[model samples]
Target: MTYFKVLFFTLCFLAFTTHAKEQPLKLDKHLSVFQPYLGSWQADFDVAPGTKPVQDVGLWERALNGKAIRTKHSINEGEYGGESMIFYDSKKDSLVFYYFTTAGFYTKGTIKVLSPTQFVAYEEVTGSKEGITKVKSTSDLKDGKLVVSTSYLKKGEWTKPESRIYTRSNQAVKFK
Candidate 1:
């Protein structure tokens, strides 16, 4: 009787494992838009003439079985940094983005695809020290460089935009 019980359990476990392995994985097709950002990138923003440009590094990778893209970024050698999750919402037919920073600020937004390598994310600010009410973040890839611009809306007026250009890095970026 003990031998029979052990054989029965072993067969059940094998059957369950085989069934699980036979299941196929489904990934979102919209996630392909972020394929260009799937590697390491480095950017140096021109702040002023005499001062050195602010340096930032970004690492983007696929997560959640390719249903989402996650970005890990750092500014000025980890002086400040943030991570963001970007996914497509089939129900809304829009791209969704959620960003959280080490500085204790978080923002949610919806993105609109402008081209195969260009997109714009619109966000509403709540507790940001920058005091911006609405934010438009546009990202474009040109000549192997990623160009990103952030435009702020303050009191219903659009302010001067901040932009950055990031180059593809040969080495991979490590995320903590």
Candidate 2:
């Protein structure tokens, strides 16, 4: 009787273990346009006319079994941070994303892929007290660097565009 019980337990364990293994995740073909940006990066941007440049660290990775892309970025080592998730919207037939920031604002956007290494994003900001309601950005990856230029619509007026250049880095993103 004891031997039979031990054998039964062993069989159950093996069956559970075999079923627990998961298949490898494969990135959706629609996300191939973001391949160049799927890694850690660092950039420095001038926040003001004479102030020193602030460093921003970012990480991008495949998420949700490769059905979506996730990005997290921090500025000045945690002064501000945001996380974004990009996914394909089958009904809309486009790539859509949402960004949640530590600054108490969030954005919903759509992406337009131009080439293998270039894309444009249009965002609508919500819950911002600064009256920034719209944002448009273009990202281009070339020669081991990522360049992003952005413009903001605040108080119903368009602001001057600013650009940032990012390179591959080993830094990690942090939030305070």
Candidate 3:
């Protein structure tokens, strides 16, 4: 009887271990990538001379059937950025990005996360001096700073996009 009991317990443990290993990753279908982005952000931009350097404030949230992340960014240098969508598609396992800017640009792309703190999204421009536009966004905690990036691109024969890094400079006020 003791031998049979030990055998049953061992089998049960092995079954549980196997099941845990095969568990599917869970994604919040109701949460767009934007939900993770909701918060105050500080931006430091690199600008050319004769053009004053720029910095800004921004807000983000989820939208569109809980399928996209949207951002509304404002600058102190007399320019305003409009809302944009960042969608995560589980079927293709990629982040679909789309944005229409008042500055006269409509761009789209897919985002691949290389790590929890690093990702790059890119697609092409369709009209009027067409080129591939890529944006690399990376975030990390450093001395409690929240950093992100929206890198620029000038596609010439499919060159890779550059990276942008943003660091949190102020105390984060939770709005949950």
Candidate 4:
């Protein structure tokens, strides 16, 4: 009986180790969808609906051995800048992002990939001048241009979306 028990435990341990070895920690294949956005871009931010667009630049780079993508963006010539870390969460089966801004604000959001070239990110906002609580941002890439529309939730209703269009930068954008 003792010998049989020892054999059974050894087999179980070996089986567990083998299974663990087969599964390495890595990003999901769906991460390839972000490949097209892996460069530098320049865009303008609409201060309000149909208002003048403030110049901004965005840089996206692969980081952490391809496990995540990091974004650094400068708005209005460094009036405000932010960094975002985007990664796939295997446990949640979704893409997650954490954003920190120079204005002492932070947002956590999840990206729902609508397709390879389109995605929607819903964010919970805090520490803004208007006290915005929630925001929904939709992004689509077309003809080598990236367009993003963001809507804020106010009084249980989604407000008009502010849109921004970004074009690929042939030259690097420098921020102050």
Candidate 5:
């Protein structure tokens, strides 16, 4: 009788583990707009004209049992880095994200999906002493490349937008 009981328990454990392994990821349907960006990408661009180009590497992946999307990026081989986690907020009925940087600042933002290939983000900066209080960015994926443009609000004035184009890459994001 003891042997039979042990066998039954083992079979139950096996069944449970198998079910767990086969469970599907629960990503929110709203996140489908970001599907094309779910890989590593690299971009080289000057922060300002006439300056040396900085190399930025970024990686995007699903997180928190697919409830959120996590993005990690580094500039100039880890001279600067940041991580962002984006998830759907049921109360707000929108997708929101929090970004934390190595520079002792962070931003909270909302994303609006305009189309299958385009989205925009508006962020409120906190803990920045450089007088930057707001930021807006738009990303569009086209022809296997991603184009991102950003504008910064500094000291109550909005700056001109700058754009960058990124291509799929195999480089890993690193932090110093």
Candidate 6:
């Protein structure tokens, strides 16, 4: 074939091959979410009408030497703060969180990837039958603000819904 035609075909082939090799970005590592949520946070939330008062809780390091983040959760004017669970799930691309408050209640849940910076954790039931408990929690960053929304689900549908807004205050702590 002509030299010009051969060169054109080669260029086209190279362009297609190069573009095909480029893949979309995904949550490949835990650090992608951990680096942003490692520090302190105050969550404003509610339980039931005659339940405990609405609160803003302070979160901080409860321990230094560990693989997990040990946080102390405090109220606006209360001395007692809830200590909670903080860790990342590498395989699931999610974050695990837990808390037991002064009202003597235990809660645990997760935040899962819906996108790179956005996540929502829905209720999950584990066990064959007879014995099971529900989980309710979710969070995401939107419009330069981190918004957390929660709900109770039965058989994978929302039963009760609530939401809270949080802003990233401190610079994210980083480590290599």
Q: Pick the candidate with the highest lDDT.
A: 2
TM-scores, all candidates, are 0.76, 0.83, 0.56, 0.75, 0.82, 0.50
Give, for candidate 2, the lowest lDDT window spanning 10 residues: 18-27
The true-structure Cα RMSD of candidate 3 reads 13.2
lDDT of 6 by residue, 1-176 (tens): 69999999999999999999986333325434534454566655656788776555554452333335565555554544556665676676567767655544555767666776677764444441423256566667667566776665555555666688765444222211
Q: Per-residue error at 53 for model 6, in Å? A: 8.6
Ranking by TM-score: 2, 5, 1, 4, 3, 6
lDDT of 6 at 141: 63
Model 1: lDDT equals 0.83
Instruction: Report RMSD for candidate 6.
Output: 15.8
- The superposed Cα distance between candidate 1 and the true structure at residue 148, in angstroms, equals 1.1
Candidate 4 per-residue lDDT, tens place, 1-176, comes to: 99999999999999999998894344446576888888899986557777756888899888787789889988766777899999998899899999988888788999999988999999998776666778899999999999999899765688999888999975454556
In angstroms, give how far residue 135 of model 1 lies from its true place: 1.2
What's the C-alpha lDDT at position 100 in model 2? Answer: 99
Candidate number achieving the greatest TM-score relative to the actual structure: 2
For model 6, what is the alpha-carbon lDDT of residue 92? Answer: 61
Q: What is the C-alpha local distance difference test score of each model?
A: 0.83, 0.93, 0.57, 0.84, 0.92, 0.57
- Error (Å) of candidate 6 at residue 93 is 8.7
- Residue 96 lDDT in candidate 3: 75
Q: Candidate 1, 95: how far from true, in Å?
A: 0.8
RMSD of each: 7.8, 6.4, 13.2, 13.4, 6.4, 15.8
What is the TM-score (0 to 1) of candidate 1?
Answer: 0.76
The C-alpha stretches of model 4 lying farther than 4 A from their native spots are 1-28, 45-53, 154-157, 170-176
Encode model 2's per-residue lDDT on 1-176: one tens digit a residue: 99999999999999998878864356798886786688899998768788867999999999987889999999988999999999999999999999999999999999999888899999999999899999999999999999999999999999998899999999999998
Better of 3 and 6 by TM-score: 3
